[model samples]
Target chain A: MNRLFHLPLSPFSRKIRIVLGEKKVSGVDLVEERPWERRMDFLLLSPAGQVPVLQLNGTTLSDSTAIFEYLEETIPEPRLLPRDPAQRAEARRLAAWFDIKFQREVTENLLQERVNKKLMKSGYPDGARIRAGSANIKYHLDYMGWLLERRHWLAGEALTIADISAAAHLSCLDYINDVDWGRNAAVKDWYARIKSRPSFRPLLNDTVPGFTVPSHYANLDF
Target chain B: MNRLFHLPLSPFSRKIRIVLGEKKVSGVDLVEERPWERRMDFLLLSPAGQVPVLQLNGTTLSDSTAIFEYLEETIPEPRLLPRDPAQRAEARRLAAWFDIKFQREVTENLLQERVNKKLMKSGYPDGARIRAGSANIKYHLDYMGWLLERRHWLAGEALTIADISAAAHLSCLDYINDVDWGRNAAVKDWYARIKSRPSFRPLLNDTVPGFTVPSHYANLDF
Candidate 1:
């Protein structure tokens, strides 16, 4: 049986879950882990001690990007990346934008403070950080709206890892009620389309202890 | 003619430069860009305003990881990632270890304080950050030494993107005389092999206007 070490609120972990769902890979035993605990056994399995570690094909794989790429190579059905090299690079580029940039600007600021701190029993959330995250997210929503105006999905006509990556981060923020859907109609529309996918259903059903999900999070028409 | 927007000490940019050299890709113009400046033209090319942005095959590409993967797909000579899926995953895992983890723990604290501060005409380097970066790097070097104690290269028996990514960051740190070569014999040995590559020579020769190269910076025998 393929086992996965993951966390509910981790955007990177969420990315793999969506990818797994998109690929229709069933029978994956999702093992929720708190990487901050630094368990010796888990550390042995993943040296970096980050989540979304997949134990498949008799190998242990960590790093969400590496895992995603491996899955792409091993299971090429309904390709997450485009066939053309240029389009594929663009997809990967957009994926990086969310994973690295959006993550640093919005997710880390909002989710890390509002969610991870409470889960880990850490200190109270900083007002400065929350304010910064709130301000930063507006710019990002505008940017996404700008992109979605021309393209059906984040990258192009078809759904790609780019959309999955962005949605993964946005979903986590949305859980904390950080996303302002009214900020950009195009972005909201894009999210609504992706949110309706079967692959994204599992994430909506997830209920993190002590944290309540916003009513619209699970709504297909959201 | 193909053009590349790069910087002398940006580890991400250096990764592309070394990759280009390793592939013997010539006749490309190198344009140095300071992303922090937020230049309108550069931002148009890279919405993220980061380097190294490569204009090749009549397209603009950003995000080092995305660009590297694109180059790997288009130019498959002397593969940087292994053929086997597991090994390829391992290679990418190591690459991210440096690009994300090490970049945060060490490079951002040290280089961003030491180099970027001076270059950007920002305030003086913070003593706290420099000390923190200095302390944090030893742990990473130890981690690399631990890995090198087993594998010939970072990923396995081959010179992969893992080596290039690690070397790119360390090379920048070596410029500021931050890396302690004596702390880890295996890491030093591994670096010696990589630093001696023709691809690495250009990086060794690079000079920033306000910074002097350490005496042993360009020497292969260091």
Candidate 2:
């Protein structure tokens, strides 16, 4: 059986969870890890002290992308990355967009304002950062809207790693009602499609202490 | 022929340049891009307003990882990323270390103090940022030293994308004399091997106006 160390609100961790669910790796044990607590075992698992560390057999893997590739090769069923090289590159590009761009601008900001305060119970929220996040999210939502407007999925017709990466971050933000779904109908519909996936059900059910899910959070149709 | 809009100092851009060189992709037109200028063509190529943006065939590829993957797939011979799934994951992990961890602590600070100041040509260097950069770099250098002491390369015996990623960032930092080579002998030796590579010579030859490379910049053994 595999062991996975993760945090509920972490997009990277959620990415791995979704991938595990998608791949149907049922014999794995999922444990919530608080990296900030600086547990010795966690440090031994990953020197960088980040979550989403997976232990398979005797080897441990860090980094969500690395884990994804490992899973793709080890399992190779229900492919997450495209078989065509160009298409695979496209999937990776979109995944990087959400992980780096949207994570930084949208998810990080919302977490700092909504989740971090509740979790850490310290540091007052800055209006400027929150405002910046709101403004930037609109831009990103519009970009996603444009992409979803054209294709059935974020990367293409098939559901790829990109969709999982995006939904991970958006799901976290959605928990605190930071996302304005009304900004774009296409983007909203796209999120709904991704949200209803069997892999996403666990993510949708996640509830953080001192935080409550929005009215639309558990609603599949919303 | 492909077109690359790049800033010579950018590690991400240099990573692609090395990939192009390694793949023997000839007739590549290199256009020096100032991202701050925010040209419409560049924006069209990359909405993130970063370089290197590769206008290859008809598709535009942005983000170094994406561009590198595109090249690797298009040119299957002399691969940069390993063919084995686990090895590929290891390579990506090391690459991510350079891209995310080292970039945040070292490259970002050095760029702000050294290149960003010159590019912006604004106020004097921020003392705190420079101090933070110097202190943080030593720790990273020490960690790299420890890693290199065990393996022939950063990730393993084979020089993978990890080596290229680390060298790309270090080479840029070296241009501004930000790296303290005397800090760690093992790390220095590892860098020397990377410096001696044929693809890296062009990067060393780069000279920005109002900024001068150290005398050892061109010396391969230095």
Candidate 3:
């Protein structure tokens, strides 16, 4: 069977799981591994020692975006990116926004500090970083709200990887109860729609040992 | 005429510039812009207030990877990505290695600390960060050396975006004379080959007002 090496709360790993789920691609087994464990075998799969490594068709694939693009090319069903090149670019741009920008500004600050630090037995979370992440999330939510006001989805008429990427990051934060859902009605409604998807269901069930799954995290209405 | 809003030292910007140059796609004008200026018009082009935004065919493109993908699709010659999906994934994975991992570990520590701080009038460069970045780059160079020892290019036999991405970040560091060419023979030879290319010439010629270009920066024989 094909296998995936992933961490439960890693936004990148979650992004791939959602993609795989949404595309309805099957026969893959999930292998949860904390990257900090520095398993030599896992390191061989991904030099960066990051999660979301996929073993498909006897080939090993690493990097969330690279894996997503590969899947899209080979599968092409329930298409995640738009047909037009410009629209595809827009979807990718937004995907990068969440993966890079939002990850740097919000997820790294909040989730890494609060969750991964503890899991890795790293030093305590910095209070300043947590505060900065809290502040940064508001701006992101407002930006998302503004975008939703103008379109049915983050990229356009259809839901794309852009939405998946943003939700992936937000879901990790949401698991930690870091997100302020009350800030934007549009974003909340959007999240609710995404939350109801079967692909998202498995993610909500994920539980890290020390961290409690928040009450609203698994709720469809949340 | 088409236009690109870019910063001379930004690796992401340089990546797009080299892609455009190698593809020999004409009619795009370069508009150097400091993203910190927070120009409303520029922000309108990229809400994240980042550089290397491209204006072409009445469409505005942000994110260097997005722009490169668009260029590859619209102008197919001299492909920066491999035709095979698996090879393409490997190329993209390494590209991300430089863009995200190397940038965060090395570039943000060295270039952003030393150059951007001075240009932005931010406080003095953090000594700890500079030290961390300096120590981190050795491992990266070693990793690149290992890869180059096996493959003709960073990704594989073809000179793909993986090489462009790694060279882009290194070129910025090179501008500050931060790269230790003596550390890795394979990486040095690979860089020398890439440096002699027509696409890399303009980057070597770049000059920032407050910093002097290193003598070896533009030397093809170096």
Please say which candidate is ahead in DockQ: 2 or 3: 3
- Tell me the tens digit of each residue's lDDT in model 1 across A69-188: 999999998799999888999999999999999999999999989989988899999889999999999999998999999999989999999999999999999998999999889999
Q: Arrange candidates, best lDDT first.
A: 3, 1, 2
TM-score of chain A of 2: 0.96
- Which 10-residue window in model 2 chain B sums to the lowest lDDT? B114-123
Residue lDDT tens for model 3, A169-211: 9999998999999999999999999999999899888888898
Q: Who wins the TM-score comparison?
A: 1
Per-prediction DockQ comes to: 0.93, 0.67, 0.85
Leading candidate by DockQ = 1
- Model 1, residue B56: distance off in Å is 1.0
- Please, what are the lDDT tens digits per residue for candidate 2 over residues A1-222? 689999899999999999998999887888999887889988888877888999888778998888887998899889988887767878888898988888788777778776776676677887888888888999998888888989998888888999999889888888888889899999889888878888889888878877778899979888
lDDT of 3 by residue, B1-222 (tens): 599999999999999999999999778899999999899989998998998999997999999988988998888998999999999999999999999999999999999999999999989999999999999999999999999999999999999999999999999999999999999989999999999999999888889999997889999877
TM-score against native, each model: 0.99, 0.96, 0.98
User: Scored by CA lDDT, what does every candidate get?
Assistant: 0.94, 0.86, 0.94
For model 1, how many clashes? Answer: 0
